[model samples]
Target: MTIKPFQVQNMLRHYGQHLDQGRRMARYRMLLQRASPEDVVNLSQDGRRKQLVEKIAAEIMDSLMVSGSSNPVVLEIKEELEREFGFGMEFRYLPLEPELQILRKEGEELTEVVGEEKQTILQRFWRITLAKVNETML
Candidate 1:
């Protein structure tokens, strides 16, 4: 299934650092103020800070399936998010179900079979993502 656009916005709201860093930090804490007790359970699970932050990051990143296999920007995004937000785990893997993996592999194979002329959809997707990110940063 395609990733829903709302999910993208939610991820950005939860994790993206605003160009105004202090505003972004305030936004995150404001989000926590609305959390349920269960949601806040990670806060004191191991330590007061790092563990909780990593747990929250893992929870957010677990919901995504970034398609690239060897993109440096992916790591850069993760590092920047972690640094800017002062919370987040290192992105080591994206857990996809078997069906999702099969679909991804098929897409890669199809790209090879179709040649470079058939990449408008991917380009459009990237454009949309970048636009969303820029809007969020603002």
Candidate 2:
């Protein structure tokens, strides 16, 4: 079984790129507090799972700096996370120009409703977790 996509997105939103480092760690810890045995069935020990998840979070956050979606490093991390917690990370590319314009317009409207800072958070969240990695990175 796969970890819910939204759950994985939540983790990245709190821990991934564009977040201040100081806040990221704290947020990561906060995120971990919500994790339960149901989230990671393979690890019988909570401590072990916590440690592993922390490491993976850091790795994913760091990898997001150099690579976006389809990043091999992130892909590998995804595999490991799936094995451990059943987390699922799916790749998507930036939309075509026309679609992108529409998305950006919508995102702008969303920003107005959600606040600019929150929009940035959501942008980074989707960028790190969904945007496909560049071909050069391969």
Considering every candidate listed, which one attains the maximal TM-score? 2
Superposed Cα deviation of residue 55, candidate 1 (Å): 23
Give the alpha carbon lDDT tens digit for every residue of 48-103 in model 2: 65555555544455434333457665665445433543333332222221111102
Q: Please report the TM-score between candidate 2 and the true structure.
A: 0.26
Q: Candidate 1 at residue 14, lDDT?
A: 48
| Predicted structure with the largest lDDT when compared to the true one | 2
lDDT (C-alpha) at residue 109 in model 1: 47
For 52-126, candidate 1 gives per-residue lDDT tens digits of 444443333332323222434345554454354344332222122211111122323421212342253334333
Report each candidate's C-alpha RMSD, comma-separated, in the order given: 16.4, 17.0
Give lDDT per model, in order: 0.39, 0.45
How does each model score on TM-score?
0.21, 0.26
